[model samples]
Target: MHTEPTAQATATTHPAPTDPACDALDGGPATELCAPRRGRPRSEAAEQAIFAAVEELMEAGRSLSDLSVERIAAAAGVGKATIYRRWPNKEALLVDVVARLEAPAPVRTSTDGSVRDELIAMVEYMRQRGLAKRSRWMLKSALSQMNSWPELREAYQEQVVRPRRAMARAIVRRGVEEGVLRSDLDIELLCEIVIGPILLRTVLWDEAPLEDPGLPEQMVDAVLNGVAAPPPDGRSR
Candidate 1:
């Protein structure tokens, strides 16, 4: 319910997207979510209206599964036929809704600077994301459902983890290529090492609260100083 930009998930931002808010809950388009966009050249106005309604519903304190197509159509001032034409089912609609809300992959900064700085940025990004309102809840909910249904786990990995890994991989790769990072280290392994603690703190353990002062720096040290250990020369090669 605390929708204001808290500290979860990449700075915990969510101030009702500036400009006229678009649907933040899409899995891309209807096809991606398995909603056949068949029929006439669907009404653009209708689609926008539905997407907007989705945003409003969430902002107004309604969840994805809690909403119905009938309610959405009515809220958008459109017809049931128009709603059903694009989205075959509520799940597909919800998928699209989630996709819309999803943020893009994190941006990689110059690792050529220092391994310390690169990793600090990565941890900061994860820490901020962990502090987000909906994202934090979503992660906790996913783990709870992972026992009965594993796809929720996969969905979380696909949507959240994969993008983050890609970002971290790039940073690590850049460091290695520039000789700023040790060449022998496995980048993927490094990726897991870098992010595992953040996930543990944020998702699994939930021991370290984001409000804890100086925690971000501690996290950065735990990852960097461990993985990017200097070579036998007793200095970073």
Candidate 2:
């Protein structure tokens, strides 16, 4: 008669404990402490795959105009949504690819070097980049077509060219202030005088050699010391 109550009766008598922190606002059953994230986490492997796919396509003679998110995704073995999540469109993706190929410009600190040394470093960086681009057919082809693509061209100017020009200007300005360079010349003109030859060789003259490691130092020194020959009297020209 006094036997233990049925298991179902005992279970009904005692309820499971609940955590107040996990309870919903409406006082419903306890939920997870935090809401689940909305989307999948980014994967580095996937990103690298996408970049490789783009490069491979370009290397295979596929023009940027012919590339699409769908094609890239298939080549990369990822969903189109993955590429879209990272880049809004094909142009944006291509910009990143170009940037990866070119790499970042060198940065020099005041404590590490002088303005002349910085200028030499900048020119050397361009020389190396030119050599690298020449070695890669894909990069060469992509860069050759950049001018015709307005979006890509503008982005390149904003992201790469502008920053480099600004750096050159800063260095030139510092040189002028320190009396290392002539203050009579315009800053822009001075910048062109310093880096113009290297830029021309790198971007325009395909036959120009960039293999000479001493070329940067020679260029900087020549510009600083002037190319004009000395008069017989050893007086200023």
Candidate 3:
């Protein structure tokens, strides 16, 4: 008797290789979908070179529009296919670069939940990052093209702006809970108040230097003492 032939095993479809750098880009928390496993081992050297090339171009005052995938690939010493395989297009690549540059190390503050101290540290951090000359040009470029390139704007907000704001809001909420600030405070407005100065200074007065080294202190003081309620006898006034 002839035995029935065994059924052939179905082959699994393997996904193409992805850039491992995407997993730790800026070391921020990324979803699994965003950072897929690499089918092939990643080249650390190539990834570093690509990042350096993008940063170098931005630091040298090159317009984002002037950059192309080919130029970046050439500078990175990798083929166009490599860049394309990682990022679908130039805009996506630029967003990743901006995210990496803008994502600062997490801000640490007093463990006692002191809002004033926390605010001061946060402001100083923002001032340093926002006013840096090299990054300023890149921010300006991103802001200018937001209307035309909505995806770029969304990426910027998602990768750079939103995380910082969420952190700041949490700090404010903690302040309210710890009696450091008034319970009736408008958290969103307070965050905006602290960040407004930095935005104005960076974008509106690009040519001028920030003269006040104690600006962070000034901001914290205004938020804490200035807005704080006066004593029953008005002794605080």
- Show where candidate 3 strays beyond 4 Å: 1-42, 56-62, 100-105, 108-113, 133-139, 207-211, 227-237
lDDT (10s digit) by residue, model 1, range 1-237: 111112223322121111111112223321132222335454555666788887787677665546788788778777777666666566545545554544333344333456667666667656665665335454344235445545434554444444445556766677677776677979887667667777777667555677654675787676556656678889866
TM per candidate: 0.54, 0.77, 0.67
What is each predicted model's overall lDDT from 0 to 1? 0.56, 0.72, 0.62
Candidate 2 lDDT tens digits, 102-139: 73567644424787897888788889889878887777
Better of 1 and 2 by TM-score: 2
**TM-score, structure 2 vs. true:** 0.77
Show where candidate 2 strays beyond 4 Å.
Answer: 1-42, 109-111
Q: Which stretches of candidate 1 lie over 4 Å from their true place?
A: 1-52, 55-70, 79-105, 109-115, 134-156, 212-214, 226-237
lDDT of 2 at 222: 97
Best by lDDT: 2
The root-mean-square deviation over C-alpha atoms between each candidate and the true structure, in angstroms, is 10.1, 18.2, 11.0
lDDT of 1 at 234: 97
Residue pairs with colliding backbones in model 3 are: none
